[model samples]
Target: MRSYRAQGPLPGFYHYYPGVPAVVGVRVEERVNFCPAVWNTGLSADPPLFGVSISPKRFTHGLLLKARRFSASFHPFGQKDLVHWLGSHSGREVDKGQAPHFLGHTGVPILEGAYAAYELELLEVHTFGDHDLFVGRVVAVWEEEGLLDEKGRPKPGLALLYYGKGLYGRPAEETFAP
Candidate 1:
């Protein structure tokens, strides 16, 4: 067997590949923006909390702070191209208002083709290193019919998975339960 190690800070350290991609939607009045993010996850179950780590430099960062709410949408693997396109562009330069989206109960934009979406109300912001964690309490949720089983597990659907850099992947077609 062979192994490799790094002692100092690793640049472009995306060793944690294949993360579920989430399109974070934010709106400030008439302006709307969606940022593709992989650094997001469910934080709590009782209070139903979700968090997304975003760099302050991103345009959506300021909008999210001002609006005090946002929506997280998960598109299927077939929409991987759209996900990448949204992430590559910035709201400051490009106007994504024309994108196909509908406002959630909290007024945050939800992608039209998203299989699942969550409307969140901002609860707290924790700064860690280069990014700030925007923690939000899940206020409303929308899920496509027949996507999840009784246990809330996906039923043979391909989820968008990011592999860092400019790559994407999908899970295998096999499922196991014990």
Candidate 2:
């Protein structure tokens, strides 16, 4: 096994760690909910599986489990206000779908400015320590035209990347050349 430098575990260490930020949206009946998530990734290519790790204490957790499906938004950048608003409140108390947010083709709510979105069907749920890992199969996807270039690959610019301690940033504009 390869070994790497170790940083002592600390809360919000993710604030200094670079990672993509994602917003997960789901609706239960007439109520819609949203949450900011960074603990997610594409798990497979053949079956098109993805996974998100959420703490059980979050209201969005129950919603996702009950709904068995959800829409996820991956933003390119510049929506800090909405991200802060959604992350600061609980869905039970606030209706995040009230304005600006809309439902997708799969009936799941999604936020505007999300350059890429995916509607997923829940496949499995497993408890791992303090968080539950949810695996989903992609059923549908919607991406903004600009996100992918003419050849069909992601273009790098203004994509939102987060560091755990309430900080966010975008990739630098071509600081290097081939």
Candidate 3:
């Protein structure tokens, strides 16, 4: 067996861990919203579980506590600019709907023209340190039909990936390999 070493936490490891392809949007109550989160991940396949981590300091955290629902929208390469835009701004300062949005299956606002999306209902939340881990069950999923190939798989051209603080990159070609 080969020896491996675990490095100490870096200043921005969170940004470098393969950025998720979905824009996580949630409505807490009334008009309060949160800056979109990128720390999302797939947790299970059997029951179709997913989750995103929200720091306690974030406005989305309190929203998640009360509303318990959110929508994750996947954007194609064409919407990288919007992804960066949403990631850069905080919802506490502006009504996200004023930006550019569409009504999704769940009636929550989704970034208009997203490649695909899923509306989820929060099932449980786990608090860890400064962040809360929210696990959710997907209630509905929709995507643009033409984007898929003859085999019914998403054909990739450009997609957004994030790396620590203000850095964004496209996924490597092989990154989408089946």
lDDT of each: 0.89, 0.82, 0.70
lDDT per residue (tens digit) for residues 1-178 in model 3: 6554656654445725657556777765455343556777878877878888888877667777777788777777667677777767777765665657766676666666666677788999998766788999988877777876666446655456666577767665564446
* C-alpha lDDT of candidate 2 relative to the true structure: 0.82
- What is the full ranking by TM-score, best candidate first? 1, 2, 3
Best by TM-score: 1
lDDT by residue for model 2 over 69-130, one digit each (tens)?
Answer: 99878887678767867888888788887747778888988888887888899999999878
C-alpha TM-scores of all predictions = 0.93, 0.87, 0.80
Q: How accurate is candidate 1 locally (lDDT)?
A: 0.89
Model 1 error, position 98 (Å): 1.7
**Candidate 1, clashing residue pairs?**
none
lDDT of 1 by residue, 45-105 (tens): 9899999999999999999999999999988888988889899999999987678899998
Worst-scoring 10-residue span by lDDT in model 1: 149-158
Candidate number with the higher lDDT (1 or 3) = 1
